[model samples]
Target chain A: MEKGILETLVGVLARPTSTIRSICQQRPIGWAIIVYLVASLVSTIVWIETGFYDLEGMGLPDVGMPTIIVGSIIFNIVILVVFTALSHLAASLLGGKGGYGGLFSSFGFASLPGIFVAPLAVVGMLPMVGALLSGLGNFGVLIWSLALYILAVRENYLVSTGRAILILLLPTVVLLVLSGLLVGLLLLSV
Target chain B: MSRSKIIALIIGVVIVVSLIVLFFGQEIVPPHPRVAIITLTGPIQGSDGGLPFPDTAITPELVRGLLEQAEGDRSIKAVVLRIDSPGGMIAASQEIGDMIKEFEKPIVVSMGDQVTSGGYYISAHADMIIAQAGTITGSIGVIFTHLNVDGLLEKLGIEMETVTGGEHKDMFVTPLTPERRYLIQRITDAAHDQFIHTVAEGRDLPISEVRELATGELFIGRQALELGLVDRLGGRQVAINVAAELAGIQEWVVIELAPPVPSLFDLFLGGGSILREMAIARLLGDEITLLRTLLKTYSLPRY
Candidate 1:
């Protein structure tokens, strides 16, 4: 019998090495991408609806319905595609054997943790400990997803754990520094 | 079951729970019988939020939005309009009054310190009116006032220039020309007739009796009741009880409709609005000056 999608997801979370190996071998990139995209969209709509972004220091307002839908789709697609592409590039540079398609499948499946993390981010928007909880929860999800992604990368490329981590962190660190610079410029101009 | 099968079930539960939360995020609570209270305490004008600053008054758009909300909510059995104002723009008053008249739910007007002129105009069409004994109401006519300042300009050695497409366009200039006075009276009389008819039909009183009371005379709540301008002399609680009885609801939650909270940007914008209000207050100097300015700003000419 074929494993159900839920079974595959549970496998991806609990047994990342074997799950990434199977996912890469099967190469079901389309289904994996759709799952990631849909989860991202739903979580985005929840974040907007719950007024989660109405916290201090963000300088963003409570976005409306149309903005939520359009912005979520654009932000999710761009971020997901860009991050997947960057991982593929990093793996290629590191002399890994996997193609862009396999890396995409591995990373998309790796985003399964977001489904659980999104609600926690929402809960963090509550009154007293809201900002701290939201930050901690999101940070926890990031660390968890990073761990899963490292395993997926390692399995997909037949690379060592150290190599997989290097592949993942290179693009992420560059993007963070670039975005920080951009934000700093904007603040100075303002 | 196997370990993978158990994990699959757990993941299924998580997915279902998350989906449920996302879909029903906005309206988590169920509905119940409610009476919406919309308080109008200042000059009624256009919709809220075209201005940079905050407004404490009822706008035409605000009242209509609240009415629409009450209408759509299955839990809302009735509406209570808590009104306290000397008067405001005729167009705004009529707009709000028309909405109140068209509403299917029972509405009771609770008059506070003062609900006269355009304020009365809006509330007259309600199912019932309740006023406090000390309330000043029943100013049923319209007035148009303007600043002449012709003598002041002349004394200051400033010659006033005028340009107009129509001969009557400059009627707002001081020295109170006879033609301008006649025009003003004609406009006020037409508006007065409309007011009288609305009050007469709404209160089920005769046209003649309404015309007698529509002489721009402000009356105390007790006097107004004696003259049939008001239904009862009581406060907000009595109005709420009467509204509940009319809507066939014994007990209901009260929903007060206020304007939405302003954005963070509004805190900065509020400064400009305060300066504008201060300028107007300075020009006002006293009650009569304030009244004159209000009439100039908000009075709508029927012509």
Candidate 2:
């Protein structure tokens, strides 16, 4: 039983290395490009409708809400191009076999889980109860991140989990730092 | 770029644009919690998903809701009940006060222009009760008011056409006769006893010590702080800064939950009443701070 467990563990770790290499062989950096493009687009659109685009002269350009609406489209397309370019390049380099249909659908897949958060946010509409629910709900992103990484490096789910978690930390941490800096600036201004 | 490449780019752009519309429809503007807020809006007993009212008078259930919110959230490490109420039902104040004590969090009280009677009773237990310089806090005791038209009608007026399980069931809205005054005082005294007990427990003093301060005096924010009624005289920013300092977190996320629904009645009030909206802002804003302040207080309840 112990020997079998050891084999399973080895397979889990080694599986991702092969899967990643194979995907890379098919096309280089395909997953990273898609993730960046989709995330940026989604974030932009969410912010704009939230009247975040109205936060002009507060630091960012005080873009008109309608203009922001239009910009969301443009920005999303920008992300789609850059992200797709990166992914296609990775796939081509790595010899992974996938079509544009799969690639595009894969982008859609990344966003599907985000809607689950709406229900939690709905509960969060309560006072403290709602806030707690929303916090837990937001953690769903971690789940989605894991899925995305595993989808890219499909061989060993365990290894994919680790890699996805580690790689995605880059963007999340950067966002945190950026928020921290913004907070500091606001504090200084105050 | 080739024609196919251009076409692919256009298609990608179109998809991004469409997705953007869906995304914008749900805009993700970040929340800014300006101050310490505890929401007490809505009927103390809520209805279904219909529009909730903020103007509904304060109730004990509302106080209970505030306490529970203050107790559970980590962001609310410290609290200042920004009360602008005339007071609420008798049982509500007492039970909410009880819940307030069970809270291990530091609570300060800030009375707006009108914290009186039962409002003052509830405020009595806070660590410090701060009232605006002109803020009125304390009717110093309890008294129930009712229009006694029974005798007025008996004199050529009609009586409140009614029946009751007990003689006192129609106590309120009945004539305040001498006998009725005694009865009302007796009822008020019982509730008053509970109120004073809360004061004593909250102040960490003997009932006698609380009684000493019960000369039915009301003080403003600065004076309240001096008299141990409130800790300081300040607004939302001060409360939030205090909580932040206490929590020892410089870079933590501060989240404030928005109200679930809007009031349709608010439409009749002419949507933009600055003063009323400011009050609403205070209530909703404080809950977020309570969440920060009560971090350890709400670590985990067994049940």
- Which candidate comes out best when scored by TM-score? 1
Task: Write down the worst ten-residue block by lDDT for model 1 chain B.
Answer: B266-275
Residue ranges of candidate 1 with Cα displaced over 4 Å: A1-67, A73-190, B1-30, B46-53, B151-158, B261-303
Which candidate ranks first by lDDT, i.e. highest? 1
Which ten-residue region of model 2 chain B has the weakest summed lDDT?
B42-51
lDDT of 1 by residue, B1-303 (tens): 877788868765775665576456336633446788988777665544233333456677667767886797666899899998777777778888899899999999999999988888888899999998899998888877656565655655668688889888877664567878888788788888999999998888999999999888999999999988889989888999889999998777776866455544543234334434454456655554445544456344521
Least accurate 10 contiguous residues by lDDT in model 1 chain A: A51-60
Off by over 4 Å in 2: A1-190, B1-36, B39-52, B61-80, B104-106, B151-170, B248-259, B262-303
What interface RMSD does each of the candidate structures achieve? Answer: 9.1, 16.0
lDDT (0 to 1) per candidate: 0.75, 0.49
Candidate 1: C-alpha lDDT: 0.75
Top candidate when judged by DockQ against the true structure: 1
